[model samples]
Target: MTTIERELHIEASPEIVYEVLTSPEHLVKWWPDEAKVSLAPGEPGTIAFLPDYPSVPLTVDEAIPVSRFAFTWAEDLQVTFTLTPSGTGTLVRFVESGHADAAGHAENVRGWDHFLPRLVEYVPTTVAA
Candidate 1:
């Protein structure tokens, strides 16, 4: 199995970053064009990337406020976000695993590359607001 891992340092507290990760309202600002998900573990939800793709189903596997949030989607592919405090900000470690092939893995790498930066940019604005 192939796993895609990324680390980001954002100038926001873990609690704030956690909200951005789990809240539908906050997610759309940086991730899928639309998000319909619950923070409770085992709950099912869907996120749509908009015009280009259909909604993808996902199940919340874990939600550990300010520390970790994880979900499983698309053939049991799992994405985990681990956050740790760093000075006045948060360090986010993102991991996506269970890819069946390199092609799928690479596609997600590109996808995350494009979207994760948005998270970095969006979070700070929330702090200011």
Candidate 2:
């Protein structure tokens, strides 16, 4: 399985980071074109892009509050977000695994790089407010 992984340092606490990561409102701000997510494991969420597009599904695989959040996204790929308390901030190790091909792998790698910085930038502002 091809895996895409990246680490981001967000200037916020782990609890804050996890909240932004799992919350539906915050997720829409940073990921997908739109999302409706529930953070509990075994519960499913829906994602949609354009009006003509069908909603895609996502399901939480594991969630351990401020420590780990993982889910199955886009049918096959598994995304795991691990939060570590670093200094006064958080180190988020983001991973998506089980790509079916190299192109899909590369795209998702680019995808995470594109989206995670949004999380880094968005977290502190919201958490501080």
Best by lDDT: 1
Report every candidate's CA lDDT: 0.92, 0.87
User: How far out, in Å, is residue 15 in model 1?
Assistant: 0.8
Off by over 4 Å in 2: 51-54
Model 1: lDDT to the true structure: 0.92
TM-score of each: 0.96, 0.92
Candidate 2 overall lDDT versus native:
0.87
Any runs in candidate 1 off by more than 4 Å, and if so which? Answer: none
> Per-residue alpha-carbon lDDT of model 2 for 15-113, expressed as tens digits?
999999888878877877788777777888888766754598899999899999999978999999999999989999988898999998888788788
Model 1 lDDT per residue over 15-121, tens place: 99999999999999999988889888888899987687678898899999999999998747999999999998999999999999889888898999999999999
Error of 2 at 72 (Å): 0.2
**Among all candidates shown, the one with the greatest TM-score:** 1
